[model samples]
Target: MNTNSNLNYTQTGDYLLPNLTLNQPRKPLGKYGRLRRTYLKEQRPVLYHTMLLNGSLYPHLMEVEQTAENRMQQTMAQLLKQNPVPDKEQNQMAWVQHMNSLKAQAEELVLNELIYS
Candidate 1:
């Protein structure tokens, strides 16, 4: 007599951290699972920020909240003004690209400060 044993496992958040959190689930986990998918957990920050903005921060920024793009552009302009290219013959494209990267960094800094503050 010969017997065969097989264990087929379905990953139901077994690989997830104990403190993992998810804001939205892409699909229902079905009746067979309790653990939420990681893809669903990836967007928690956006959802959490949305909730914060909608709940307590809404009325506070009703008048003068600046868009992220605008902030970035402003930062870029400042950087350009401070570090303008030497002349029209200089590497204009490279200068512009560096300034744009600086702008993105500034924008990230702005976002982080706002979120953590």
Candidate 2:
């Protein structure tokens, strides 16, 4: 019996291949996860390969994405609190522009801290 954590491997000739079963359900990667995946692949290939070989790449990426999302939300909330938006009905365009800028600022911070770092 050859196994590693939740995965099982079967030997055929001299090679071993993982036998993945459908009992476990995994969520598909989201926007942040995809971005982090690309960054790891392009910028940190060796670390990415190490995690991939150890069957930890997906989980790690998912964790990073979750953290990034949580951080982004928190940052957005803080930004909103610090600089509250004006009335939406009276000045719809200005409100939209302000909200967009705030969101962009939060996104930049999350990307810099979690994805790029």
Candidate 3:
């Protein structure tokens, strides 16, 4: 009901979701195969947070957050396994970029669920 609160925490007493459209990656994923799987897996916590904030505490909703976190952890593990970094020379910038990208994607996915639900 309060659009200003949804847009900014200072007005709503809650943190506004990240703006993904304004900071999308230069190289978008060509397909949504991996993305969809990750999203579906991670939809749990996001749902939980949304429900919690909305004043409806559903025990079942907690599973959404747990499941999503598990899926994301597993995905990150797989990615790290597939791409090993050198010991002496680390790509700090690349690591930062990747982390930021993942964070943005997660936030976007959660925000999308909240907005739609």
Clash totals in order: 0, 0, 5
Residues 1-117, candidate 3: write the lDDT tens digits. 235434432333575453322322334332232344344446656754564455443332343455555655665666667665444346777777776666566655643553223
Best by TM-score: 2
Question: Model 3 lDDT vs. the true structure?
Answer: 0.48
Estimate every model's Cα lDDT from 0 to 1: 0.45, 0.86, 0.48
* lDDT per residue (tens digit) for residues 61-102 in model 2: 889889988998899899999999999999999999999999
Show where candidate 1 strays beyond 4 Å.
1-66, 86-89, 115-117
Q: In model 2, where is the ten-residue run with the lowest total lDDT? A: 16-25
Of the candidates numbered 2 and 3, which has the greater TM-score value? 2
- Write down the TM-score of every candidate: 0.35, 0.80, 0.35
Which 10 successive residues of model 3 have the least lDDT summed?
19-28
CA-only RMSD, every prediction: 15.3, 3.8, 15.2
What is the alpha-carbon lDDT of model 1 when measured against the actual structure? 0.45
